[model samples]
Target: MKAFCEEYNIKGGIWNDSNFRAILEATMYLPVTDKDYRKWLNFFFENCSYNQLLFNRIQLNEGTENKMFSDRDLVVQRLEAKLLRYTDAKECETEYCLKLTSVFERLDLLFNNSWKKDVLDLITRLPHEQYNQDEINKKLSFIYSNEDCDDVLVQIKELLGLYDFETAKSENKSEIRELLKYPHYYKVLVITGTTGSGKTFFVNRYIKYCLEKLKIRDISIIPYVFDISKVVSDSNLEQLLIHEMADLLGKSVQSLEDASKLLSYLPIKICFVIENIHLIIDEKSKWNSLISCINRFSRYEEFKWLLTINGYEYYALEDISNFLQRYCIEKNSLLNISKKRLAIFQHAVNMDELNKEWHVVETILQKTLSGRMSNTYVDVNKGITTPLEALYFRECIEGEEWVSSPSTYYEFIKKIFDWKANKLAECNSTTVQSTVLVIVDCVIEKLNCVIKDSELNKSDLSCLRSVQLLSSTITICKENFSVSYGFQQISYRIRVFPYWAAIMVKNRFRSKEFKVESITGYPAELKEWLIPCYIFYNAQNENALLSLFPALKKASLLEYALFCAQRDSSVFSKALYNFIIKNVDYIKSSKRCYSVFYFVFYCPLRISQKFKLFTSIAGKVKEFNLLNLYSRVFKSVVHTSKKLKQLKKNMLELAPCDVLDINYINGYETGEVFMHLSNNEEKSFDIVINDIIAYIREHESILEIIKNGNNSSFFDFFIRKCMENYLKSKKKI
Candidate 1:
C-alpha cells in the first residue's frame, strides 16, 4: 500500500494541510499534475470516512458479482466534483480582477489619475459584486471633484420650473391607483391635451405619484420625452432609443435583440412613461421596433407602457389613421385636470387667497373700457388655463407692473391696423411692402385704380418701413389670397382686410371735428381727389349727403357716384342729375360718359323716381339748355336695345312737350342718321322700329291723329326719308 501511494504522490507527500493548500493554488492554473490529484485524493481519504455498511448492502446478482469492482471509476467521479467547485471559485476571482482593471482605466480617463489611489481603496472595501459596469460608471459620472452637488440641484430646480398650486385630476388619481393594483388590464394609456394646456405637467404628476406611492424598483422606471420637430428632421431611431435607455438604465442597449434578451429574464416589473409620443410618426421603422418590443415583452405580465400626445394633432391624425387610435384610452382626464387647475386659480384670485388682485382686474377692465376695447379680452372662463392667463393672474396677485397703460386709445387703434398690415405682409415675401402700399393707397387716395403687377415697384414699397417707425407693432391675423374680379384679369387677389376701409378712415380722420362739412365745401381739385376716401368714411359715419356734389372733373366724380347710386341713391341721384345738366358739354365730350350713363340707366331705382330727380335738377340748373344733353341721352338710348322704351317714356314724362320739343326732335333725327350709317346689328334700330310699329298698331288713335294733323307733310316727309335711308344702308351693307 505504501508503494502504491508513493507512485501516485511522487512530486509531493499526501495527507497534509500544506499539500492540500498547494493543490488549491495550482487549480487556479489549469491541467493539474498526478501529484496534485493524488494529494487531493489523500486529503479526502484521510479526512472523509466511507459508509461501508451501506455500500456492502448493494449486493450484485450471482453472474455480475464475478465482474471487477472498478474502484477507479468511483474515485474519478468523486474527485471531478471537488475540482469543479475549485474552478468556479477561481473564475469568480478572475472576473473581479478583470473588472477592477477596467474600473482603474476608466478612472484614469475621468480624473487624470488624481485621487485614484484613495478611490480605489474605498471601492475595494465596498461590496460591488452585484453592481454592473454601467451602474458603477453612472454613479461615478455624477461625482465631480471641485463642484458641490447643490449647484446641480439648483439647476435641476430651474429646469423643472412647474407652477405652484398645480391642479390634480381625480380621474388621473383613480387610474394611477388602478394601474398600481391591476396593471395587466391596460397595455397602454395615452394622455392628450392642447398646446400649453398642461399635458406634460399632468404626466409628470402621475410619475411623481407612482414613485411616491408605489414600490417599483428604482432602475425599472423609464421616462422619455421627445421633441417632434427635431426628431422628424434627424430621423435617427437607434440613437434616440439608445440615449433614452442610457438615461434610465445607466447603459445603452446596442440592439433590439440584446434589449429583448435582457428584458425577457428580468424578474422586476418595468413602467415606461413616454411623452410627446406623436414624434414617433416621424420614423416608422423605429415605431415598428418599439411597438414590437412592447407587444412581445407585454406577455411577461410585468411591463407597462404609458404615452402622452398633443390632443390637437393626435385627434386630427386619429380621424385619418388607426395607428395611434388603437392605443387611445377614451377619457378626458387632461380636460378634467385643466378645469381643476383653472378653478384653483379662479378661487385664489377671487377670494384673495393668493393676494389682493381685485384692483388689478378692475384696472384692466377700466382701461379696456375707457379705450373702447372689448372687456372679454381678459375674461378667464372655466375649463381653460393658458400660460398667458396664468401669468396675468399670478402677476396681478404678486403686484408686478402691467405692461400696457391708458390714454393712448388712438395709438391703440393704430397698433391694431399696423398688426393687421404686418400679418397680411407675410403672404408674399417679395411683394409684401408693395401689396401693403397698394392697399393703403387705395384707401387713402380714394382712387379705383386696378392692382396691376406691372405698375408696382420697390420704390412704392419703401413706405412700409416708414409706417412701422413705431416700435410697438407686431403681426396679427393670418393672411388670405384669391383671384381678383373686374374688367381686367388680375391673376391674384390681395384680400382687403375686413373693416380695412373703415379702420383706415378711423385711423386717419376719425375725430369728431373732421366732419363731412370739411370735405363737402373743400376746393374742386381736393374734392375730386378725395372721392374714394369719402365713400367709405361717409358710409361708416352716415355722412352720405355731405360728399355728393362735384366741384371739378364732373364726369369722373359722376361716374363713381353713379356706380354707387344703387347702394345709396338718396345722396347721389339729385346731385348727379344737376351736375350732368349744368355741365352738358363735358358729359358730351367725355369718352367715359357712356360708362357713366350705363351705370345710371341700369341703377336699381324706380323709373318714375329717376325721371323726377332728373327733371327737378334740370329745371333748377341755370342756363341748362337741354339740346346737347337731350341729344346724348337720345343717342345712348338708341344703342341700348333693352332700355330704349324706358328712356322714351322718361323723356315724355319729364318734358311736358310730348316729343314736340325742338331739342328732342333734333336729337331723334341725329340718332336716326347715325343708326342708318352704322348698320351694327347689336345697335340695330330693328328692335326699336318693331316696338314703335307695335305701339302704333296698339294705339290706332295716335296714327289717325297724325294723319289728320296740319303738320302731316312734315310727318310724311320724315317717314319717307327714314324708309329710304334704312333701305339704302341695308343695300350698301
Candidate 2:
C-alpha cells in the first residue's frame, strides 16, 4: 500500500478530509475500513483492470468444488502443461482447440453455482432500490402490523400538545414502559417549549427514566442526540449528521444507507435525536432534507427518533404529519412535556434528600449561601416556570441581601458570562470583557436589537446569548422602548449595570478603555442599564481624567440614573454616587450643578444609600449655600410624597431636621406638577402655560415623557386650556 501510495503521490496514505479518519475506521457502515482504505486507494490508482483486485478478495473462496480447475492456479497449471507438451505449433493448436472445446462443455456446470452479481455490487456500489422481497410478503406484513389494533398509543399527552397534567402523569402505565419494549410502536418523539423553559433538560430526565425503568445502563435507546440549530444553515444537514454519527460510533458511514447498515449491526436499539429541528423549516430544501433523512433512517427497525422544536417554531410545525414518515402518524405517537410534566421530571431529578419533591434549589442555597433559609423564595404553591431560575431565585434575588447590594446580581452574571464562554468551548476567553463594552454602548444609545456586525465571532454572540438567557426582557430582541415587560423586569433585568458601572468607573480613573476594540451587537438586550452606560461614557476620556472625570452635561442623564436607582436595587445608586463624589470637581464646575444636585437629593436611594454627594459638592463650590439648597429639595421630595400637608411647627418639632436623615418613598415626580399648580397664585391661562413650561422643562422625567411622544392627562389638559385661553384673548384684541 505504501509503495502504491508513493507512486500515486498520495501523502500519508489518507483521504483529504481528516475528520473522515474515524469514518474510515468504522467497519459497521462499510465493507472497507481504516485497514483496507489504503489498499482500496492503491487498487483504484493502479494501472490495471479491476478483475485482478476482484479475484484477490474472492480468489481463495471461489471454484472449490470443481475438480477440473479447483483454482485459478490449477487451471493455469493445466494450460501450461498443454503448451509444454506440444513441439509443433499447428499440432499444438489442433490438440488444444479440441481439448478446450471439451473443457468449456464441462465448465458450464459450475456457472449455476458461481458468485451472484448483486452480492458483489453490494460491496462496491450504492443501490438505487432495496425492498424487493416478493411483493406479496411485503404488502401482507405491513397490512398485518397496521391492522393489529384499532388505535396505538405511542406517546404521552405532553408530546401531542394535549398537555393535560393527569393524562401525562398516567404515562407510567404503558406509554413510558413501551419506549424500550421491542418492537417500538412508533419511533419519533418531539418536544417543544418556550426559550429558557428547560427543554434540553428534559432529555436528561428521560434518560434517567429509561435507566431506572429498563434496569440497564448502556443508554442505547437514543445515545446520539444532536442540536440541529448549529448546522441548520448547511444545505446537506442530513449528510453532515451522518458524518457526525459515523465519527461518534467510529463507523465510516457514507450516507443514510450506510447509517442504516450500521444500525443493523448494533445489538442495542438506536434512536436519532435531532434538537431544534424547526430551525430548518423556513428553508424548504433543508426542511425536506431533514424530513427525508429521518424517513430514510426509519427504514431500519432500530432507528427511532427524538426531535425537540421550540414553541416559536410550532406554527411552522403544526400539521407536521404532512411532512413525517407514514409510520409516525398517530395521536399518541409523539411525546412532549408540559409545565406539570416538567415538574414530575423535576421531582424525579430533585436529587435532594431534604425534600424528595424538591431539593435541587434547597441544596443550591444551602451550599452557596452562608445563612440563607432553605426556602427563602422557593414558593411551593406557585410551581417552577424553569428549575434553573427557581434555583437562581432561591440563591440570588429572593433573599434579604438581594436588594441591599447588587453584588449578588453581579456574581450571578459573572457566572453566566463564563458559563456561556465555557459552553462555547472558549473558557476564560477575553471575549467576556469585550462583550461588556459592546453591551454598554448599545444601552447608552437606546438601541433595541443588536445590529449584528460581520466581525462579531461565535464567542461574542454566545455572550449576547447568555445575556438573553439571563432575563426575558433583554432589549436586543425588544421592539418598542416605550413598552415595558412589567416592573420586576425593569427592576431586576439590568443586574449587570452596577458591576459594569464599577468596572468602567475604575478603568476610567486609571485612564483606560475596558477591553473594547471592535464589537458587533453590544449586549443591547439589557438596555435598561442605559444610565450606567452614560455614566461610564461621561468618565471615558484622558482629557477628563486630569479633571477627575467629566460632569454629565444633561440633567436628564442624571435624572434617568436617579430613576433607575430609586426603582431598582441600590447597587447602581451606590456606584453612581461614588463616581460623582470621586469626580466632584467636575460637578462643581459644570453649569448643570443645581439640576444634578436636585435629582440626587430627590431620588431617595442617593440619600438612602448613605452617600453625601452634596457634602463633597459643597466643599468644592462655596458660591451656593449647598446645605440650604439640599434642604429645599429634600423638603419638596418629602412634602410631595405625602398626601396631606403637615403644619410647619409640627414638622419642625417632629424630627432633628438633618437633610441626610430624610426618608422618602421616591417615585416618578407625578406630584411635582400639582405642587407647582398649588404654589402659583394665578389661575389665569398665561400663568398656567408658564407653570406647564417650567414643569416640563425643569423636570426631566416629565420632559422625557413629552419628548417620547407620550403626554400625561394633566399636561394634555393644560395644553387644551392654553389653546382656549389664546383664542379668547385673540377675540378681545
Candidate 3:
C-alpha cells in the first residue's frame, strides 16, 4: 500500500496496519521546523480527511455492528502513547513543536464516544443563571443518539445557551409537562410571552423534557425545533420543516403534501417546536393555511406541536386562530418574577456560591471607594429588590469624596469612570480588553438618547434600567432660559443623573477626558457609561471649550455637544466662539462644520453676538467659498421674529460688497416663510403680508441692489434660485 500510494501521490499508507504506528512515531520525533516533516503531515491530513481514513482501516469483529469502534482501536492507543511521550519528555521547546496532542485527544474522544463527558462538564460549568444543566445534558444525549440529523448540530449548540443568561421558569416548565403528557388531547400548545420574557427558553426546556419522557415510555418520538426568526423567506419555513421531518423520520418529503402523508402513515410520535410564531402570525392567508395543515396532521396521535408567540401579539393570534380555538391545548403566558420573588432571586444571585457573582461587585467598590457611606444618602432600611438596583442604591448613598485639591478630585473621578466602564464590560461579557472597548460604545448611544429625550421633556427613567442608569432631575443650569423662538425649554430631568455618568461628566470638565480616538474604536459594550458627558457639564462656564482637548474638536466629538445654550443661558460665549473662529481653516477642511454651525444657532446669543459670530463664519465661508454654510443657516438658524428683524436690520447697514456674502442666506430664509405661509399649496402668500412687508422694509437696501441690477446675481439668487423652489411646490399642486 505504501509503494502504491507513493506512486499515486496519495497518503493512504499512513493508515495502513503496517505503517500506522511507524508514521505516528516518526511524526512524534520530527521537529516542527523540519520542512519535509511538515509537508508530510499536511499531506497526511489532506488525504485522510481527519480521522475517517484511520477509522476505516481499523478492522472490526463480525456481528459487532452497533459497536461504534473496533476492539483493536490501535489508532487511539498509539496516539495516546505519542501524547504521553511528548508530555513526559519535559522539554518546553519540544512541547510547542509537537502540539498535535489535542488532535489525538479529539480522535480518542471520537473513537471511544467520550465527547459526551466533556460536553456534560461544560454544561455543568456554564453560568447557572443562563442555562439549566440537566436540560442541556438531556438535549445533548438526544442529539447524540440522532447525530445524523442536520438540525441536531445547531440544536446542541443553542441548547447549551451560551451568550445569554437564563431566568428560572420552573413554573412554566411544570405546566408544559402536564400538557405534553397527553399529546392526543391537544393538537397545539402555544407559549406566549413578551419579548425577553423567557418564552423561547421555556419552550426549549419543555421540548427536552418531553423527549426524555418519550424515551422512558419506550415511544419513538423525534423532536424537531426551529426558531422562525431564523427563517429568511416566505417559503423557507415549509421547506425547512419538511426537510427536518424527513431527516428525523428517515423518510422522503418532496413537498408539504408529502410530509403530511409521511406523518399520517408513520406510526411513531413526533414533537415539533416552533418559536417566534408572531413573525408570520399577521399573514391572514398564510397563517390560515399553516393552521389547516397542522390540523390535517393532528388527526393522528403521532403528531404534536409546541409554538411560541410574543404576548404583545397574543390578541392578534387569537383573532387569526378563531377556528382552531378548540384544538389549542394550552396558551401559557410567561411572566417576569414578582417583586417579592425578584428580591429572593437577586439575593440568591448575590450569594451564589458557584459563580461568586458578588465578588466582582466587592472588587469594584474597593477600587472606586473615595469616601465612607453617608446615612442621609445610604438608606439602609430601604430593601433593595434586585442585585443591580442594590448596587445603584449603594453608590447613591456612598457619595464620592469631595476633594478640596483639584488634582486629587480629577484623579478620583477618572478612576470612577474607568471602574464603571470596566465593571460594565465584565457584567456584559467575558470579552477580551480589545473587544471590551468596542462594547463600551453603547454607553455613548444611550447617553445621547437620554439627552435627546430630556431636551424634549420626554425623558423616561424606565429606558435606563437595562443599562443600570437612573435619571433624576438635575439642575445643570441655575437660570431658567425661556423656551420661545425654537429654543428647547430647560427640562427638569437634568439634575439627578446616573452615578457613573455623572463621574464621566465630572472627569471631562476637570480636563481628564478619555481619548475619543482610542475609546471610540472599542465596541460599545455598556450604555450607562456612554451617556454624553456634555449633557450634564457646566455649559454656563466660559472655559468649557478651552477645557476640551484638541483631539475632541472634530465633528464627531462635537456631535455629543448638547444644543442647550439659549439666549440667556451661558453654555457657549464669545471666548469659545473666538477660539473656534481661530480654527476656521481647520474647521472648513473638516467634513463636519455642522456642529460648529449648530452651536452658533442652538446657543442663545444677543442679536449683536449672533451677527458677530456669523460675520466670523461668513468670512471663512467667503474665503473657502463654502455654499453649504449659507444653506445650513437657512435650514437650522433659530431666532424670534424680533431677533430676526434685528439681524435683517444689521445686514441692511452693511455695504453692498459686505452684504453679498449673506445674500443667499437671507433669500433662502425669506423664501421659506412663503413656503409655510399656508398648508394648502394653492393658498396665496396674502396671509403673511404684514410679515413679508416688514422683511422687505427692513432689508430695503439689499432689495435696492437687486432692483438696480447692480448685483444681478443677488437678484437672480433670491427670485430664481431661492424663490423658484416654492414656485415648483405650487406647480406640483
Candidate 4:
C-alpha cells in the first residue's frame, strides 16, 4: 500500500478516498505483495463470481465488445484507458511493467477457471446478445455449478439415456436427452425419478443447454423455472400460471386471455418450467387441473411446460393420454456418477471423504458412461438377491453414502426449522437448543413411531424434512478450502433411507415407543411402502414382523421387506432370515426361491443360520446357480463403495479407542470389539464418544452443522470409518 502510493505520490491514507474502487481494481490486476495478492484474489473470486461480473464487464469498457484486441498492445491500451484514466499513462507502463506482466500471468489461470470460460461461452452464443443477461443467469443459478468438469449440455444425455424414459422403456438405456429438439418431440416433458434421484439437477442442466447451448437457433428459446411446491397445493393452477407469467413479464394478468395475449406479443416461445408437480398430483383435482391447463396451453404457441414429478407419485399418472406419456421421462436411478455430479455433491455436503472423490468418479465413468443397463426396480421390495435388485441397492443408497451416485439437485430448500431458515424468515424467534430438540422430535420421535402418509399429507411440514444427508456450505478464510462446514439440515432420501436410518434411530435411542408392540395399525404408507416398511423392519424378533406384514405373492409387503434388508442389511438380515425360514415351504412352492437365495447371499446371518442355511440350501444351490449370485452380490458391493482401501487409510487417523460404544457401531455380531483373534481384550470407544457427548451436552449450537457438525449425524459414519481403519491397522483384512 505504501510503495504504490509513495511512488504515485498520493496525498491521502487508504480510507481517505471513498471513490478509490478503480485504484483498488487496478491493484487487483497487479500483485502488490505475495500475501496481499492472494487475499485480494480470493475475495475477488468469491464476491465477483455470479453477482457483479456481468455489470463490471460493461463498465470496464463499452466499445471493446465490438473491437478485437487483435494485438497484446491493444488489450493493454484498453486496460490503461479504462482502469488508469486518472493516472498518467506513460508513468503507469514505465513504472509498473513487471507488476503488469505478473497480473497478465495470473489472469491466465483465472480465465482457465469457469468465470472466464462462462464469459467466453456466453460470447459465442449467437443472434448478437438477443439473450437477456438476467434471464440467462436466473436459469443458470438453479443448475449451473462451475465445479462440474463437464458443464456442457450434451453431458446430460449421458444421464438421460440411462433411465426408463419412454424412449428407453421398450429398449435398453441409451445416452440421449429426453427433450429431443431434432425430431421436435419436446412438449410438457415430465421427468420422473425416485426422491434421491437427481431430477431438478438434470432439468436445470437441460435448461442451461436450451438457453445457451442448444443448436436449434431458428427460433429464440426462452426458458423459465419456478419451484411451485409451496404454492401449488391449494391454489388455482390456471390463475397461478397466469400470475407467474404476469410477474415474469412485469405486467398485470387477470385471466388466461391476458396471459396469452402478453405471451403472444413476445416473439420467442416460452419454455416454462414447473417444479415439484408431485405435490399436486396426489390430489386428483390439482393433477387434473394441471393436465387440463397443459391441454389448453398446447393450443397457444406462446409457451410450453416442463414439469418434474416424484416417482413415488408418478405411478398414479400412468393412465394419462399416451401422447403426453411419450414425453414422460422415467429417470433411471441406476447408472449415473459424472465428474460434475461428484464435484457438486462434494461441495454441497463439504464431503471430500479422504480426498478420494474424483477417484470414485473415474471408476463410475468406466462402468456406466458408455455401456447401459436396464433400470427396473423402483422401490426396495425387489429383494437384494437378483442382478437388478443388487443394481438397485447400489444406485439407491441414500445420504452421504450416495454422494458418488448421480445427483439431481434443484433448490437447496431451507429446512423449515433450521436457524438459518428462522434467521431468514422469522429472525431470532427460535433458539439453537430448541432447534436440536425439534430435530430429535421430528426425526427420532415423529419418524420412528407410527407415522402415516396421512399425517405427512399436510400442505407444509411443521418441521424440516429429516430424511436426507445435511446440506453444507464452503467456508472461506483467505486460503485453500477450509475444514469448517455449515449444514442446512440433516436428511436422508437417497433411498428414502427407509432402511438404515429407521433402524439406527430406534437402536441409538433404544425406545419402546417404536417397538413391534406399537404395530397396532398400518398407515397409508402401506400403499407407498416406505414409512410402514421402516416401522415394521424395526421389529426385534421375527414373530411380530411375520404376523404383521407377510410376503404374499403380489402384495407390496414382500417388496417392503426386501427394501429393508437391502438398506438395513445387518439389522434386517437376521429377521428376514428367520421369516424366510418360517415361510420356506411356502416360498419353495410359490417358485420364489430366487429372492430367498438373494437374502442368503448378501444379508448378514445369525451364526446358527449361516451354517444351517448353507446345509439346507446345499441341494438347491446347485440348481439355482447360487455361485454366480455370490459373485454378482460381491461385485455390486465393490462398485457402490467409493474406494474403501483409501478411505480406510484416512478414517482412523485418531488414536484407536480402548473402549468402543455399542450404539455408535454397526456390522458387529455382538456389542463388543475384540483387540485380538483370541478375543481376550475388548476395546471400548467411551473415551472417543465421551468428548462428543460432552460437547452436545454443553453446546447450544448442537445441530448447527458449522458449530457442531463434527458431533452430528455424520459421527456415526465417522465411527464406522474409524472402525474400518482400526481393523485395517490390526491386519484383520
| Highest lDDT against the true fold, candidate | 3
Clashes of each: 0, 9, 28, 17
The TM-score obtained by model 2 is 0.35
Instruction: Assess candidate 4 and give its lDDT.
Output: 0.37
For candidate 2, write residues 459-568 as lDDT tens digits. 54433333332222323344466575543211112233334444434443234443221112234323223234433344324333223212332222333333223334
CA lDDT of each prediction against the hidden true structure: 0.37, 0.38, 0.41, 0.37
Per-model TM-score versus the true fold: 0.25, 0.35, 0.29, 0.30
Give the lowest summed-lDDT range of ten residues in model 4: 405-414
Q: Model 3, range 1-733, lDDT digits (tens) per residue?
A: 5433332222234323223322332334321212332354456546654576454564322223212122222222332332232222221222322222332222222222222323333343335543464675567556544232224434545665642234435554444333333221344556654322335434444443333333343223334565554554545555766776665545567875565444423223455767656555535555655665565555444455667654434555546443334355421111112343322122111122211322433333333343542212122222222223224433443543311111112222244445445544544433333322222233443433223333321222222221233222323433357454443332212211234445445544245455444323323322222323443355465554455434345433433342222334555555456556576555543233444554565456554555555655555556555555555554454223333345445543222434464655655554454344333344554533445456656666756766675553333344444346656866998
Evaluated at residue 355, the lDDT of candidate 2 is: 28
> What is the Å distance of residue 549 in model 2 from its true position?
18
Off by over 4 Å in 1: 1-188, 207-220, 229-235, 260-309, 319-325, 332-388, 396-733
Per-residue C-alpha lDDT of model 1 across residues 1-733, encoded as one tens digit per residue: 3433432243234333323333343333232333444454455545443644422342222222112112222323333332232222111123324433443233212211112222222232333334354554444444322222233233223322221212335554354334333222233455554333334444444444333322222222222343333342223544565455444443346754444333322212344556655545435654555555445434332345556554432433343333233222223221222343433222101112111222323433333234332222122221113322232333332421221211111222233345556644543467654455555454345433223444444343323222221111122333355353323322212222222433434454555554444443433423432444445345433334434444334334444444333334444445555555555555432323433433445444455544443343332222334445444443443344334445444433243222334323433453454344345435565764665467556655556645664443223333445566777867998
Task: Using TM-score as the measure, name the better of candidate 3 and candidate 4.
Answer: 4
Residue 449 CA error for candidate 2 (Å)? 5.7
Candidate 4 lDDT, tens digit per residue, 1-733? 6434432222132321111322343334431321342354355456654656543642433232123112222322332333232222222122223332343233222211222222222222322233354544433443233222223233333323323345333322221222322112224455554333445544544443343222322223345665555344324766777776666665688876666554433323466667656555436776776766666555443455667655444444556644343322211111122333432122111112211322322233224323332122232222221222223333433222111111110011111113233432432324432443343344444444323333332323222221121211223334356565533331222122323233333443345454533232323332233333343434455454554456332243353353334433455566666665555444432124444544554456533354344334433544444444433432333233233233222222111211123112211211122212112323344543454356445543433432433332333444455466456756964
User: lDDT ranking from best to worst?
Assistant: 3, 2, 1, 4
User: Candidate 3, TM-score vs. the true structure?
Assistant: 0.29
lDDT of residue 655 for candidate 1: 34
